[model samples]
Target: MADYADITYAVAERIATVTLNRPEARNGYTIRMADELGDAMDRADRDEEVRVVVLTGAGRDFSVGADLSQGGFDFDPESGPDAAWQEPAGRCSKRIFTMHKPVIAALRGAAVGGGITITLSCDYRLAAEDARFGFVFTRRGIYPEGASAWFLPRLVGMGTALDWMISGRLVDAAEALSAGLVHRLYPADTVLEEAYALAREIIATTAPVSVAVTRQLLYRMASAPSPFPVHELDSRLIGGLGKSSDAVEGVVSFLQKRPPEFTMRVDRDLPDYLPWLHDSI
Candidate 1:
């Protein structure tokens, strides 16, 4: 694994864990951190050995948003060396958005500002009982970034999205879970362990190719014009997989009451339509 200054990366048992490492700053985010995160996520996505990714912070907090020591100047787009501007925070979110494997967020302590937006793009977010969050850009005299304005409404309903962004109030883990922002909540000390357990369920029982293809279809088709596109993709995938070795093994294992050994690899076994290959489309 490549070295990263702001985050730690490790893959074990088909699960990749990306840790935000700036505990002293409460994991305050920075542009460098964003680049490092994007790099780490990309690494996990391309590694065929990896089936799931878990993102969590190192210590007391997930991230308190950007490193604001420079105050307003920190957000000045013109201040950065890159002249052709794009939203720096959004790039990391996009990386998570595009990943083939499921990305799960394990949140403890303060998950506010960029912290919340970043996790919004993840497939599932699990919060510690002590977790607290806010869409605090309005309170900070800015608006939501990291393409959160787009993702927030989709994850939580538009009414809830507007309420949070408009009020910019800090919320507890219970509320976040109630609002559907996170899947479940656990004690802070056990949250990371819980995340791994969830990942194991996926790794142990699910077919890698099927998981990858299903993730793609769900994310892509959610914004689709109609269900027809999803149906088309589903028909293609179901038909293709019906004759695959993994499919046969899956059935026989179920009947025999044994664990399945899915041999199909996501890297080479996926049909062209799954990833929307240029030639196939």
Candidate 2:
């Protein structure tokens, strides 16, 4: 595992847990933290032993947005217009978006601005009962980052996303759940454990390669121009089922009334012809 200044990474029982470690600052979002988060996600995705990843914070709160105590963000005007620059939150969220492994976000307390935006790409979001979320970019007189403008509307409806982003209001756990922003809610103390339990369930029941492919397919093909492309892809995938070891095991295990031991690994076994893996579809 790599050493991280603002985060911690650990893998146990085929699950990698990446945590925000800046408790003293209420897990404030920083450039270093974003870089570490992107690195951690890439590390986990490449680790064949890691089946799922759980993202959480060390302190009571997940994150309170960007750290401003040190006079706000550090910007360099000398870099000029030609310099390559990417926002901090996008560094993490974009990495998560491309990952082949599933990521579950365990959020508690306040998740505001960059805090919530960074988690928009997670496959599942499990929050604490007392959690509060806000997309307060407008309130802060800044625009949204982390590609939240794309992910938010897909998770919730366009109406909810517009309302949340425009008003810049604080949304409680109940309202967030109702809006489909979060998958489930639990007590603050148990939310992390619940996330682990879900990860364990996935590890025990699903094939790593199948899960990886399906995750990518849903995210990439769901919003395609039409269902024709999806049908073509689905046909190709289904046509190869007879040769898939994991598919055979899945059926055999059910017939034998036993648990399946999937042998296909994500790193080595994902189909080479996956559309997203190539530049052209």
Top candidate when judged by TM-score against the true structure: 2
Indicate the residue-level lDDT of 11 in model 2. Answer: 97
lDDT of 2 by residue, 198-225 (tens): 9999999999888888898988898999
Q: What's each prediction's TM-score?
A: 0.92, 0.96
Root-mean-square deviation of Cα positions for candidate 1 versus the true structure, in angstroms? 2.6
* CA lDDT of each prediction against the hidden true structure: 0.86, 0.92
Candidate 2 residue spans exceeding 4 A from truth: 70-75, 78-83, 279-281
For candidate 2, the per-residue lDDT at 173 reads 100
lDDT of 2: 0.92
Candidate 1 TM-score to native: 0.92
Window of ten residues with lowest summed lDDT in model 2: 74-83
lDDT winner among the candidates?
A: 2
Q: What is the lDDT of residue 160 in candidate 1?
A: 94
Worst 10 residues of 1 by lDDT: 272-281
Candidate 1 lDDT over residue span 1-281, tens digit each: 37998899999999999999999999988877888999998899889999999999998999898886624333555666455555657878878877778999999999989887888889889999989999988888987898998998888899999999999999999988998999999999999999999999999999988887777677777898988878887888777866799999999999999999999987788887554444221
